[model samples]
Target: MSTRREARVTAARAIRSHAEDVVRAALVALPPRERTRRGLAFHAYQRQVRTIMRADPVAFEVVETRMLAEGHRTSVIEVTLRGEVGVDAGDMLHVLWRNDLDRIAAADAVTAARFWTTPIPHRPSRWARVGASGLLESVVDLSASTDSDPARAERITPRFFTVAGVEASDVRLQVTHTAGMPPRAASFLARVRPGDVVEARVLPHPHRVAHDGPGLAVVTGSGAAGVFAALRAGASGIRLVWGLGDKQLAPWVQEELREHLRAGRLSSLRLALRPERVTDLLVDEPIEQMAWIYVSGHESMGAAVDAALRARLGESVLREMSDGLRCIVST
Candidate 1:
């Protein structure tokens, strides 16, 4: 996200709480001493990837930390880090030992040689981006009370994890390839069975700040991963609803974005917010990120609220739904 506003904490918490988790490769063993060099180096490499994510976490669909530095000439690891962000030679060896580093390509080579000459790290964790908006670029170590839930996401921890994209789909459509999709639209489509067609729309939010030609989009997916991915994919402005699922996180998001925009601290601003619902409609206005908004549930309910938002935000920008991510051409 741009320096335009601060990231909201409550919104973040809501999404984190409600997000569905799917784990991948839960077993990662620590590397031996000889591999320590590569381990540490790979750790630093992961740090570089983290920085790229910090810059814009969801820039690419998949950014393998191991493939970094090796010059994986042909792959989706679009972001690169060197100079300040990349690691040192000694640090590289440390990565070899961390078990975070693994060489997936090498057939037969000495562990030491792999440590020294290993261009890419060995079998590292999978960094796949799903849909959702309002993901922080960096991985923050937030102090979490264990009483809080940390669902099926054994892959990335809830405390250290940040929001990405809110978009979802079982059919594997590339929302990042285009612009963004609303959370409801994405969720509804994500429920589609294999090869099934569902209509989705990458509509521009009415109150949302627009770009010159194409207008902007407010992304909705499961977590901050989608947010990072959407931002990385070049969506103009985003509705950071995933992480900031409610108004508590709203101030945090606002503050963070404002700090980024003003290039100053907003601690002195003394802004306060209270989430209130008016007649079954949640109401918290005067907030900049979202305007005149009431999150509606499913189809019929969605239509009623959608009509209101459409009137307020504009029906023109609110393009009709699309066939959610069924082989749409990507740039």
Candidate 2:
């Protein structure tokens, strides 16, 4: 049996090597006569796919693959991509497959679906002005006020969380450059000089800390800013599972978090490097023993945490707070 990495390489190579045929096959609507008439058209389309692949480099790790339906010659393959990228399997294939409705449908699109090729790591993202917070994390201001700035042209503003009366200035973000982050987004952030504008946005985090609650926050991954605010707003007993993948961002978000920890604002802080699971860090802890918990992180991690918490504390002690689970596809 091929490993996940091997399967990904195989998929990517197969797609790239036979791109022309795949595109042709994808154009299910094309009549047999049109294939003869469109000899040059396929070549042109092939060139476009080659160009996009060269820039993006299609690669993916297969989380799981199964046969959904079988045709005698070709089985209906279902795959889920590993890691995080904004682009889903369908969208990625769509770009290469062009506008073949039947082809797209057959692919069984998913944001993080498995792939046959080396999954392209780059995902598309919009530009936004960089706001300096003089801290470890960079801020991508997406408020209406910042969106209209000349620096931000034709960029999509991300939906962010806020209380009904809260203004833009009151919103603070801690943008972490995860492995799944787009190259453009990372480059703009990396080379950004003080006061320089860059392309970015705050991902939509629907969960907010409840107005009145006795629960403590269990924040992992990129949901730091919101939890920090909740702590400042007098939400007590924070358990921060800081998952720092690769290099640390400036002004050092940990410094502020550490300060809070020292001040007793945080109940605990566990740091995990890349390839380390946040769930592992939390597993042995007496979290279930705690009566109330408010959790936040990327969806996958959040779900794991929720399950852990539920098993430990049981349903009775668990009070509902804000759902800080991130919706976008990312690492």
Candidate with best lDDT: 2
Residue 324 error, candidate 1, Å:
13
- TM-score of each predicted structure versus truth: 0.22, 0.39
Clashes of each: 85, 29
| Model 2: per-residue Cα lDDT at residue 136 | 9
* Candidate 2 ranges beyond 4 A from true positions: 1-157, 161-171, 178-206, 210-215, 233-235, 246-252, 288-291, 315-331
Tell me the tens digit of each residue's lDDT in model 1 across 127-187.
2332111011011101111111112111112111112222221111221111232212222
Write candidate 2's Cα lDDT for 1-331 as tens digits: 0011111133344455456445544553353333332343444444444444345323333333333222222222223333233321102122111111222233322232222222321222222223222100212112112222223212221222221111222222233333333322212222223332222212222234432333345544344445555655555566656554433433344466667678666778776655787667877665544434555556777777767766765555443311122111112
Worst 10 residues of 2 by lDDT: 88-97
The TM-score obtained by model 1 is 0.22
